[model samples]
Target: MHRIFEFDDIIRAVLQHVESSATDLVNVAMTCSRLAGPALDILWSRQSSLARLIMCLPQDTWEGKVEGCCRDYIVRLSREPTPIEWEHLRANASRVRRLVSIDGFTDAPKLPRGPVLRRRTDGIGSALDLFRPILRPDVIGHVLKRLFEQFPPATLFPNLCELHFEAVFGLLERSSKFWLLRQFISPGLQALRFDITGIPTHEVEQLFAALPTEAHGLRQLSVSAGNGTAALTVPPSLGKLPKLIRLAIFAIDVSLTRQMITNIQQARCLQTLKLNLCGTSCDASGIPLELPSLKTLYLSEGSLSQCTHFLRQVTTRQLSRINISYRGSASPAEVTAFVESLSTSCQTFEHLERIYVVDKSDHPDYLLVIPLHSEIFRPLFKFKRLSSVKFIGIGNFELDDRFLKDVPIAWPSIQELKFISWKRRAFYSVTFTAMMSLAFRCRSLQTLHLTVDATQSTTIPRAPDGTEALWPTQTALRNLHLGYSRVSKVARVPYFLAEVFPTLWSFKFYERYLRNCAADIDLRLALEKAHSQLGALRNSPYENSDKLWENDSDDSGT
Candidate 1:
């Protein structure tokens, strides 16, 4: 074979591009011996189910049946496999690096969903009816135990690096799957994620207590207590993971939240931490916790007070991104306090690049009129490197022209800026002129979503000599979402927008903001026409511009 093919790295890289296409990989393996090893390795590197490895055994080793009201596909060992069958299984099992088992099933069963009445002469059923079933936790536990007796658990998948096991069964059913999950854990494992529902709290505690010894090299871990389960306890020994770098816990409570924070301080290498507090409140009167290595933090399903408390305690200068989501309403003072804590926690704002603060509640009656005043957002303005900022589901923002002009100067590197309100307001002070200031100053801005007062007539500014003033065009901006923004003189607005944002393609506004108004409908149609015109102008040559405009007007009339 060629010298390039002799190098395993080159062959592996070539095989990875076609790894998703099993047929092509198989063809390459069968075509050349030099390519076969790498091809087969890539093919089995990531497995979503264990059924393929089981089928590698002798055809008669296992029997399949469709059972239960859900028509779950199940398999049982009819007879023990011999030495030759075991060898076939071992050949491919060693190649797996990532194994994922979701919803207590390895693979989606391909068997017929309709009921089968006929039975074969052997009394099992038709040949086609014997396809793999949705393996239950109990059935999988039995099959895995029997198979492990033939081969040691550690030797089954020695090269496995990542394992994601999720099952949505009840207490007893999930308890059985835990055994199967334990067999997959090895010292070589680096990442593990579990999302089992209805499992007892003690079981979760025990699993984490043993992780340090079972998987010493683990760097990333994520666990979620499925719906209706109690808060997950944070085992003290979980901090013993020497190489742990990323950890995410969902559906945890207040006291355990404090314990979790205290426990993870021992994880010196941790860089990413995510917690879902389930809207529980906690006291913030404690010494600040320092996470020197943490770079990203995400907290969700928390109350405004709870989220503020967590931020106040966390002192991480290296943090680059923070996503905070709370459920209920918050007064202006409470919102300011939360933002103040965030700024104080991050010692230096230079490292912070992205900030996402959202209020997930949608009760219109609870909406508050939080003015978009400079003083309220002064803390966030210190983050010079900020790139993306999103605030969704918040109450009515009393926006004005001054705040809009100040935004560009604060975060010049901003790429995406979104401010969404829950209810429509009758009046807005900010006009189209203020939005143009952002396009002119923040050249890198791409996505912008804000409500502005566009009800005035569209007129191009003129210079002292009576000629139209030249304004800088922003080509990076592609999407503009004006939620619940009122607009009038819609005919000229589209042409004015095309001048400022030459490459703008998407212009969105809510028509339901004023359902009975005729102006809102006209604005939507005008924006639609501008979108079509810009799209065609970009694709066509300059010589065809006139022809395109002619076609645009003809289409607009209809």
Candidate 2:
């Protein structure tokens, strides 16, 4: 949160950081109705990413020209649309050149056949629909050819360090596709994101063949696969990107063919890697994956049997953070073993600070489950450098009483803690109590995040006699967040946190359940009250909470 100033010049800085804070923008708008348009202007100007704009797809925009659609497409159009309408429309062709963008994308049968409009979203489509104009097949291919042919020749911005193509994977394989991609991205491209949805097999191969072995300048590159079955080959050139820092890729088995692994081995400078082999992936036999500089790694899919091989093969001393996600099914015990073995093998990765093992509970097919085994800290207590932890969505039925025992011994350095359970009774569960006990046990604990399982029904607990257990003693906690699946009354949250974490500074409390989900103001008063309490905690006990709300919020003395 940022303070507001009456003078106009002060806001320019606040706007920079709060661009994504929609609620704060609304409050600023109400302060002066005139501020609404300008504030929106600042926020919408950022719809520059292709992904955000893709969300606007399949939906129509500005019927014909730029209008006030609150969708992503509008954000893609120039936030600074000149006043002269004819001139704006007239320059549509040239602006495409200057900005390196094409308004409409591929076409589908449902979309109208002619020229498309480019407002944000005044039409009827989900955020995902608005990409229709861009998803059109030929249009997508043309955008790719156009990008490669022109970017290398025109990129002049010194401040620009990265180039992100939102749905680049939309383009299919072609003869010169790899060459063209290399032509545009080879040297200057630092950050690249391609969405492979409808791509074909050969094209996938060509894309991989185009990986630049000499990409010494590459830093962060992400290639995603949207909701489509059209699989592509895994490019071996991927591992060869020179000085590659962070890479996020989703590929199928065909790309995992033997030779690509050799290329992967050649890539030794990688730091952070995220790989998702969602569907059937071929055995990654003899694929070279020797990443000595790697630090953080994330993988989705692959059995413990295969994962153990991959982890054992990587001889890197810097590997510290590991996030293993089990999408379809997996056993909690097996997952626990997989993680424990990783710690034992990657001994040089002594800096390992955090580990995240995500499992989906209800998928009966993968009847294998991670036990309500937080107390089964037996596998993890070995890592002396471990710290932060996150459990995304195990239910109450999966956990039991002895789960939280002996957790800190594995990594006495632990400080910040985040626990998210999808189980009901989390607030009242022994597991929750164990979590709290563990939170207080960590002498170095500074930031603690206790989020109830959002998928469950709501149940706020009260003390045995009427008051609720505030929390483990909050004296050591600096940042504490207690969130409900849905927003409750705002007043209830501030009182709870105030009692629990007396020194807490930043708080995000939800309370929209009582009213229309989108328009609820249940927690409005509570936020201001908390802020004043914060002010009081700083030792100014005399300040009035009501007055504090008037000074910062849009509410006037009236």
Candidate 3:
């Protein structure tokens, strides 16, 4: 007789066996009552929208009479569903572990149909103006109040862990609706993200102040002041959250930078900090702040001097990742100074694994490139454990010869590398011999992203002894992203890549079709076929056959 697995074991098996989709889990819940409890728990755990939950309410609770597209949405607010049993509502709502609020741009469910409110197009430049205007401020407030009043917070969403508001402040700024919605706050909440763009500083402060003291338990908090140049003050209560592990602040002015730095200094457990300096000048008051526990840092859109000052003050030795982005001119000297400072002050850079030097300039014609000076990148080469590196923006440098050749030798453990250049013709004359040099040097490379000119002839390289050179192959490389300058010669890409990267499983080829070419069609079909074939081999039955069918044979040595 075979033994049957326990209910919990079966549930775990179902969830863990494969990547189950939302529909698959819902199907599991409908299978039987024994399996439904756990399946329902997983299904309603992290809801992206509250619209679905609101729709589940009784039909009579919907407000206003309607016609056309909004006819079926009319109902009055009620504690319980009119015809459906209250237990049904309790079953689903009780299992909800998160409620993610959507911004105006999201196509959420219509609340009560009213006048055909035209989208305000006069001064509607912000993303908030794009809302469908279905759930007006008053309607949302009323619904939330009734919902909270009907079911006490403890029973309604006892296991709630995250409450994310994505640019939902447009509706919130009109009134103190957050106060009405405060009852939904749970002690176990781990993450909170608010993109309050147009809201006033005082109102934003009030919203932050009203948060339950459980805010102290939050592990991650991301706040972005969408309005450009408007200083969004950080509430004093948020500064001392002992359990907070990750904090991100964006679009803050110079005056608030001191307070922000002070808060970061106080947060003892913050492991990751991302600050969008919002073009704020670095002042004397913001210096001397320290981050002892920080491991990852992202600084973007700030003056070079300001960024350098902040990095000089912060103290951390365990940092593994650093990303810096700039919208304006980020001269190579400025960037080098920042890195050199870290090399001298921050002891944690020795463990750094990832670094991104990105330039997000507005005008594509105006190029902002980082010149690769040996002295500047010398400290970067010291990152022996570095695995990922990205250099984005146009530069006055050759990517194929010097840059690629030195990178592999310097960072032998590199697994991923990306270079985004403005000159499309940079790779037009690259020879196959030069390309193989990178693979030979960086044996651990897995993901490579850069433009290449496969149109050039595959010239045979000779060794010092005048013998034909044998190119080394990299089996670890799985993902290759290439931007081709010409498509006619793209058909040769598959064969060339197969030789250089034997284990290539994913290939992304980007090309500009100036004029229709037959080879472009072949390239797409070839890549699709390769992807499907590799996918089959990766998920074949033989993958885990040995585990399930153990070797039971016992051979006696005669």
Best by TM-score: 1
True-structure RMSD, every candidate = 8.6, 13.6, 12.2
Q: What is the lDDT of residue 1 in candidate 2?
A: 24
**Alpha carbon lDDT of each predicted model:** 0.66, 0.46, 0.56
Candidate 3 lands at a TM-score of 0.71
- Clashing residue pairs in candidate 3, if any? 60-76, 61-75, 61-76, 62-75, 62-76, 63-75, 317-348
Candidate 3 C-alpha lDDT tens digits along 218-305: 7777777553344455666676776887777765555456666776677788787877675446556423556778778877666655
Could you tally the backbone clashes for each prediction? 2, 39, 7
* Per-model TM-score on C-alpha atoms: 0.81, 0.54, 0.71
Q: Write the per-residue lDDT of candidate 1 for residues 1-558, one digit (tens) a residue.
A: 777887878887887676656556666666567876676676566655555566545557776666777665555667887887677677778997776543212212111121111112231122112232344322344666666777775688889887766632122255566776777678898877777565566776777788999899998787776641446656777778999988877766765456677888888898888777764457446778888999888777767778888877779979998887777777777888888998879988889988777776645443356555446776788899998887765556666777877888899999988776645342366687677777667899988877777767644557889997856687899777766665565434555667778877666655444456676577666545544554565663222122221111101100
lDDT tens digits, residue span 1-558, model 2: 234555467666656555455445545655654454456454333223222322223223211122333222222222222334323222222222111123312110011122122333342211112122422222334433433343342242222334434433323364444444444444544555556454565665566556574345666666656632333344667777777777766643433434434555566777776665444444554523456677777765544434544564455577788876555444555555565667655656467777765553345232333344454445566667877665554333234335454655655677765554432223423333444555556767776545432222223446779975544555666655443322334334334445555665555433332245442353344444555565555554322222221122110100
Where model 2 places Cα greater than 4 Å from the true spot, the runs are 1-160, 166-183, 195-216, 224-236, 252-262, 279-289, 301-315, 360-370, 374-376, 395-405, 418-421, 424-437, 446-474, 478-501, 504-558
> Ranking by TM-score, best first?
1, 3, 2
